[model samples]
Target: MKKAEDAQRLLRTLSTEMPEGWKKDYAGVRNEYRQAMEDAARQAALEINQTDPEVIEQFKKLRDDLFSSLSNHQARWPVLLLSEQRSVEYRQSVQAFEAKHSEFVRFMRQST
Candidate 1:
């Protein structure tokens, strides 16, 4: 989704010297995601296809994992910005971790 790409850009930007008030903007965006997710869940509940117990169980499992990983994902961003130098090595390491975490998210999305 275009919004997902936009989120990645803003996130990377936040790691590289964010603008004033960006933290509040980031939190708001996060809340928006929660709201959207809730809306999707409501839609799922209404759909006739949502009757399967196994499917519902899988969705619950993924939701738990997603929230747990979100904590680590948020922590990693500030860790990437730890040094004032912002060396290539640090960037590369954080990028690699980000890639792996992104893949984890993709897996979670598919699971749900």
Candidate 2:
């Protein structure tokens, strides 16, 4: 859990960097981040389910919102999209969503 949070932060930092080495992998990073968030959300739900089902149910909505937002922004960047402000914002939003999701999950763990 703590490890995931740390890894997420590192990934977020990476997302903020220029897409030099990853010229064609910017979208891949976003997609992979989305996938990782979904997995984390699922784990969080499972953890919460042990105590209160409804409490964990909220994570699913957050997860859905994250994916929907990411999907809408996918490949919608300017021409020659080599990672710009738009990508940065989208990545940041995804990071924020994950951070909140992780916080929620951690809180649940503590309470449980």
Q: Model 2 lDDT vs. the true structure?
A: 0.56
Poorly placed runs, candidate 1 (over 4 Å) = 1-9, 71-112
Best by lDDT: 2
For residues 1-112, could you state the per-residue lDDT of candidate 2 as single tens digits?
A: 4544555565555556754664445445555555665666667666555666666565556556555655655445422563555556665756666656556655656544
| lDDT, candidate 1, 4-107, per-residue tens | 44565665676566677666666666555445544544444454245678766666565455545555555654443444576776676556655644554454
Off by over 4 Å in 2: 1-16, 50-53, 78-112
Q: Residue 97 of model 1: what lDDT?
A: 51
Steric clashes per prediction: 0, 0
Model 1 scores a C-alpha lDDT of: 0.54
